[model samples]
Structures are given as C-alpha cells and as structure tokens.
Target: MIQTIAFYLFAGLMILSGVLTIMARNPVHSVLWLILAFFNAAGLMVLVGAEFLAMLLVVVYVGAVAVLFLFVVMMLDIDFASMRAGFMKNFPLGIAIALVLLAELVLGIGAYRAGALALGTPDGSAAPIVGVSNIQSLGALLYGPYIFLFEMAGVILLVAMVGAIVLTHREQKSVRGHQNIQKQVRRNPDEAVVMKQPTIGKGIEL
Candidate 1:
C-alpha cells in the first residue's frame, strides 16, 4: 500500500513537472522544472527497485545536465523572442509530431497491457558476476563485459566536449583585452619592476 501510494505520488509529480517544464515562460524556470521532473522520475525508479538507475538519474540528469542547462540559460545572452519567432510558423509541424508521439505512447501502453515483447536473451559469454550491491553488480557488468563499449562512450563524450568548445569559441580582432600567455611568460623581472629608492625628503628622478 505504501509503495503504491509512493509510486502514484512520484508519477503524478513527474508528469506535472514535465508539463510545467514545457509551458514555463523563463528558460531558467523550464530547466528547474526539468530538474524537478528528473527527481520525481528518479523517485519512481527507486520505487520500482531500480535504485542504481535512480541514483544515475539524480546524479547525471538532475545534478549535472539539468544544472548545466540552467546555468547556460541564465548566463547566455539569448533573445528569447527571437528564439520563439518561428513558433507560429512551426506550430502545425509541432502539433503533428506531438500527435504522432501521443499515438505511439497509446499503442505502446496497449501492447504492454496485452503482453511484453521479448527484446533478446543475453549471450552466455557475458554472464553476470553477482556482487554485494547493485552498483557493484552494475560496475562489474560495465567494466567486465562492456568495458570496450564504455571506454568508447567516454572517448565520444571527450570529442563532443572538444567540438562544443571549438564551436562556441570566437576569435575577435576588435577585442583588445586578450591576454598573450607566451609574452607574459617571457618577461624578465627587470622589465616588470624598476628598483627605485627615494630619500626621506628628496625624490629620485631620471
């Protein structure tokens, strides 16, 4: 009974937060609502005995991704009106896509209620090495069986980070405040500072 109540509560919150995220006026507020949705979704995962998945949702989506989105929305000088300029123009296309998604969701739920479709049975080569905790079990599965795939995912993320940095970075010749690291490093103490000793009453001049 307690589990059912918790499940319903979290599910409702998840749905509500997701709606609010989309309908929010402020982009920052939308990100905050998205984070709330992530938390509620994580709670639902916890209720379903997927504690590791819940933790990953909280840590990755809520902690990092959502927070980063919020920061980006707040810091970036984006014209929200300009961004939403094509809303009316794209309204029909958006509506069609949304309807298609809703239809798919209904079909999926109906199919699930009838019977779950079997995805695939794991090959015996990658057998599970049971550990004390779910996290440990997951780590064993990821590092032992799917280590190469995991490493490749890391490399992909590294390349993506580099790509993002390169895309956003602009070299402006008009910006006079740029620092020259090599020039600063090559400077001597003599050029940086002039050793000048002035008397108590008289000042020393060139």
Candidate 2:
C-alpha cells in the first residue's frame, strides 16, 4: 500500500536525519539535519492521523525553533578544536547523564508493562466528535477543558520572556543617543524650541 511505503520512507529519513544531526561536526549543518528530521517526523504524524500534531511539528519546530537554532549556531564563534580538547574532561559527566537517561527509559518501560496505574476508562466525553476535523476536535478539547491551563502556560511564558529581558538589560549612562521616552514626554516645548523673531535686516544670533 502507498501508506505503508510512505510511512517507511518518512521513518527511515527521520532516523537518518537524527543520526546526521548528532554526527555532523558543523553546528549549522546539525541544525539543518534537525530541521529535516522535524519534517520527516511531521510526515509520520500525518500518516498516523494526527494532522494537528504534524502541523505543529512543521510550523513550530521547523519554522521557528530550528531556524532560531540555525541562526544562533551560525552567529556563534565556536572553537571546535578547543571543544574537542575538552571532550575527555566532560566524557564522564556525559556518560553519567546517558546512564541516568537509560535507567529512566528502563523504568518507564517496566512501569508500562506492569500496567499498575488505574487511569479511569474513557467515557466518550474525551473522544473526538464525529464528522469533525482533527484540528477542530483538538481545539475544542483544549479550549473546552484546558483553557485555564493554556492561559496559565501563556502567562508563564510571557513572564519568563519579560524576566529574561530584565535580567539582560543594562542601562548605559556612558552611551550617547539613548532613548528616554518619559523624559521626552515631560519636556516643555518652550525649552526645547525657541521662537526666533528678528528684525528684517538683522541676523539672528543662536
């Protein structure tokens, strides 16, 4: 079937791109590979009937996050030789983190296999509405039951962005041509501008 072939194609490409993303020496190339992986993952999501997720993968991950990452990698002056020199120093820490991640994955799999969690049976309430598009159903579910949580997340992100700006912002008294909106707003027009009335034949002195 075409679906099967497409699924395999997407999956294979996604896996290959993921490997390339990690293996590429150039950070910019790695980001490009990452974007490719995101595209293939989006394709897989479409094949799995989760079109909403596919759109999010392409729009958010590929469009925004990956582009931002590529720009950051390209802008930075990375010393690859120096980084490679420090690899052995950081190898033990990396190995420890990897082991921790592996242990977490094993625990998650064991718990899933044990099936001890008593999640309540799905009453048709959470199910997608008949004859509705995937995006519509997902939007309804998110807005209907999770509106407050969604708003809270937005607020948190807004606060975090503002906080980052505040933390990084430095007022420069030594720098010329700095903008002071409040100072400009409160200035008297008479002090800033003078009415010059001179005699017809006399030159006005500044």
Best by TM-score: 2
Could you tell me the lDDT of residue 97 within candidate 2? Answer: 100
lDDT tens readout by residue for model 1, 52-139: 9999999998889988898888999988897677666798999999999999999988887888754587777655455466777778
lDDT of 2 by residue, 133-194 (tens): 99999889889999999899999999999999999999866458778889999998767755
CA-lDDT, candidates in order: 0.86, 0.90
Cα lDDT of candidate 2 equals: 0.90
Model 2, residue 30: distance off in Å is: 0.7
Q: What would you estimate as the lDDT of candidate 1?
A: 0.86
Clashes of 1: 0
What local lDDT does model 1 show for residue 39? 91
- Clash numbers, per candidate: 0, 0
